[model samples]
Structures are given as structure tokens and as C-alpha cells.
Target: MPKALSEHETEAFRERICDCAARLYVEEGPAAVTMRRIATDLGCGTMTPYRYYPNKESIMTAVRTRGMHRFSQVLEDALGSPGDGRTRSRAVRDAYIAFARANTATYRLMFEYPEPHKDDTAYREAHERMLRTVVAHVDVMIDEGRIQADAPIFGHQIWAALHGAVMLEIAGMLPPGFDAASLHTRTVTALIDSARPPAP
Candidate 1:
């Protein structure tokens, strides 16, 4: 019998599986992300991946869940940093773009790909954590009297702008001389300024 993997080894292997699966899904489409394909790419027996994930759908979920957790962590770190409301919000914006650029496949997996299991607890929790972090940043601006809009509404608006800019960047749809970072900065600044209370 093959020796059982240690806990650390098991987690390492699982992460490797997720990484491979995400790459395949992005490059070759969903039809290419099969257990046999993953095993072949990893140079393992066809049955090896099944030991870690029960099916293709579960593997896809794990890939998305992992991406969501990492994405949330990036945003949360930016939000937790020492800065005023605008400064921290800018930090969060930078973090979001950096994460998407660095992990393009995973970013697409998390947001663009169809979810394998909408009811998956891990995905839901990670998504909620990300949303809360965003709203909390807006709440900071509200607390500082910098903006006078409902937190959730303003937060969603800001998020939509950021996501739109990022998606365009990913798709190479932005016009020449207009990068995602610059566009995002301008967009976010406008959104925030628009919410400012009128001066007396």
C-alpha cells in the first residue's frame, strides 16, 4: 500500500491541484478540466486526484474557493493598514488590481467563470468577507464625514467601477495610453468626490 501523505503534504498537493485546474480552466475552457487531464498534467495516476477531490465540480469549487480566500485576504490587508479613509481606500484599490494582475487565471476563475456550486459554504463565506471589507472601507469614509451616502450602496457602486476597469484591462479592451491603474484611480476619485456633501 502507498504511504499516506502527511497533513502538510496533503495541503500542498491540494493547492497544486487547484493551481493546475485553474490554469486548465482558463486556457482550455471547462471541457478540458477533467480528472484525467489533471492527473496527466501532474504526471500522476488517473486515480490520484480523485483521492483529493471527489469530482470535477468539486475541484472547480476548490479552485474558486481558494481564489476567493486569497482575494479577500488581499483586500482585508489593505483595509487594515494604517491610513485615513481616502488613503486606505486607495490602498484597497491598488491591492485589488495587483491581485488580479498577478493571478489572472485565478481572478477570472473567481469572478468570470460560472460557479460550480452556488451553495458552497466556503465560497459564500469568502465572498461575504470580501463584501464586508469593502463596505467597511466606505463606512470609514462615512464615519469621517467625508462622504454622505449609504455604505452598502456606495460600496457596491465603487466595486462595480473597479471590477469594470479590471475586466477591461484583463480583456485588453482599454484604449491606448489608458491603463487600468490610472483609469481606476480617476474613477474611484470621482465616485468618492461625487458622494461628498455640498460645501456650505
Candidate 2:
């Protein structure tokens, strides 16, 4: 009998499976991302992927989770640089847009396609953690007296604006002569401006 994989090795193997599955998802849509296909691509027996992931939904969850983990780190590093609240907010917004554009396939797989009625606990929690990261920055703005709104509400507004712009750009729906990067910067600026206290 073969020796069982160590914990670390198991995790690495699982990530490999998710990587293949995610690529197949992006290249051929969700229908082509079957466990057997992943196993075949990985040169393993059909049961191998099944052992790691019970079904396509679980693999999709893993793919989404991996994308979220990497994206969360990008947001962290972007906000880690020395800056004021406004500067940090702008950095975070730009980082968000960059992540979307660079990882268009993974981004679309994560958001554009939905897996309904599936137990996506890890994906949902990772999503909330990303939101909390944004909220923390908004809290900084509020505490600095730069904004006059609920931090969570304002954070969500920032997310909404960024998401809309990125999605529109990705779908090629932006108008001719429209500059997405400029629009992204302006959108973040406008959100901050909206939160500013009116001049007395």
C-alpha cells in the first residue's frame, strides 16, 4: 500500500487540483470542470480528484477561496504602505482594480458565475473578511474626521462603485473614449468627497 500524504503535501496536492480545475473552468466554462477531467489533466486516476473534492461545486469553492486569499493579500500589501487615510483608500481602490484586470479569468470565475444552494462557508467568510479590511480603512477616515458617515455603509459604497466600474470595463461595456483607470480614480475620489463634511 502507498504511504499517505503528509498534511502539507495533501494541501499542496489539493491546491494543484484547484488550479487545474479553475483553469478548465475559465477556458471551457463550468461544464468542462469535472473531477474526472481534473484528474485526467493532473495525470491521476479519476478517483484522485474525487478523493480531494467530492464534486464540481466543492472544487469551485476551493478555486474561489484561493482567489480570495490571494486578493486579500494584495489588498493588505496595498494598504500596508505609508500613507494617510485618503491615500490609503486610493491605494486600496487602485489595487482592487488592478487585481480585477490582471486576474480577469479568475475574477469572473469567482463572481460572474454563481453556485447556487451550495454550502460556500469558506468563500462567504473570506468575502466578509475582505469587506472588514475595507471597513477598517473607512473607520480610519471617520476617526480622522475626513468623513461623516457610518464606516460600514461607506465601505460598502466604495466596494459597490469599484465593483461596478471593474465589471463594466471587463464586459467591454464602457463607452468609447472612456478611460477605465481614470474613471476608477475619479470614482474613489468622488466617494471620498461625498463623505466629506460640507463647508460651513
Candidate 3:
């Protein structure tokens, strides 16, 4: 018979499953992650994960949410790091690139990998928060007269440029023999510089 879990233990087990899912998802994409696999890793019954996550998508959402939360924290830490707004912005970009490189799977899920869902409240919110952070950075630049203020979502435009470069590099869409790391930095610098086009 399976051992019954107390209320505290049940909650702890649920959290454990979530944590394990995140770790596994980071190590491997969602395609390779399954309830049975998680249960095997947890040494629990195959049905145990169902008790916590109704489906694989549920686990994917939870793992994706967890990764976004971590991303937000990384942005916060990078923004607060040494130097002025420009320097701090670069730090945030560096943190973002480092995080992607370190957690390739999470980065894939965040940008390259895609998920299907009807109601993606958490995912939407996390994406919005990420854009807001970018907008805030551009706001700083605008205050310093680095970028024009008239353009809407000027910051997100910068973000889109960054995402495009990073995604291309990760998706192996870069030039036949281009330096990804240097190209990534160059693209970011150029985007920020371009966002400051002369006012009409």
C-alpha cells in the first residue's frame, strides 16, 4: 500500500514535485518531461503527479511560472547592480544572457519553446512584467535623453530587437560562421543606440 501523507507532508510533496519539474524542465524540454517520469524520479506512484498536476501542461505552466519569477528577480538584481542606467541596463542584459546560457531549457521555454493553453494568465502576466522592466529601462534612458519619448513602447521595441537576436542565436539561425556572444552584445548596443534617433 502507498504511504499516506499528512497535510504538511502533502504540501511539501507537492512543492517537491513542482521543484523537481522545474529542474527537469530546465535540464530537458517539456517534451521529455512526463508525469510518469516525474513519479519515477520521486519514487511515488505514477498517479501521484496527477493528484498535483492535472496534466503535463499544468506542470509546464508551473515550471514556466517559476522560471519567470526567477527571471524577474534576476532583472531586479541586475538593475540594482553597480554603474549608471546605461551600465545597469547592460548588466541586466548580461544577466539575461548568462541566465539563458546557464539554463538553456528554461531559456528555450521562455523564448524558443512554445506552449498551448486557453487561459495563460500567469504566462501573460510574467511576459508583461518582463516588458515593463524593459520599458522602465528605456524610461531611464529617455529621462537621460538617450531615447525619444514620443514613440510608444519604445522600450519594448528595444526588447523585441534583443529577443530577436537572442532567439536567432539560440535557434541556430545566425550566420554560417558568426560569433554569437559578440553579436548579441553588438545587437543590444546598436538597438539602444538606435532607440535614440533624433527627434522630429
For all predicted structures, in order, the TM-scores are 0.93, 0.81, 0.72
List, residue by residue over 33-148, the lDDT tens digit for candidate 2.
88778889999988988788789888888778878887888888878877898888778877888888877777777777775634577877877676677567788788889989
TM-score of structure candidate 2: 0.81
Give one digit per residue, the lDDT tens place, for model 3 in 15-47: 677667766776775566888999999998899
Backbone clash pairs for candidate 2 read none
Top TM-score prediction, candidate number? 1
Q: Kindly report which residue stretches of model 2 are placed more than 4 angstroms away from their true locations once superposed.
A: 1-9, 117-120, 173-179
User: Residue 8, candidate 1: how far off, in angstroms?
Assistant: 2.3
Count the clashes in each prediction. 0, 0, 0
In terms of lDDT, model 3 sits at: 0.71
- Per-residue alpha-carbon lDDT of candidate 1 for residues 1-200, written as tens digits (9 for 90 to 100): 98999999999999889989999999999899999999999999999999999999999898888888888888889988897998998888889999999888888888887885878898788778867876678998899999999999999998888889999999999989887778888887888889999998
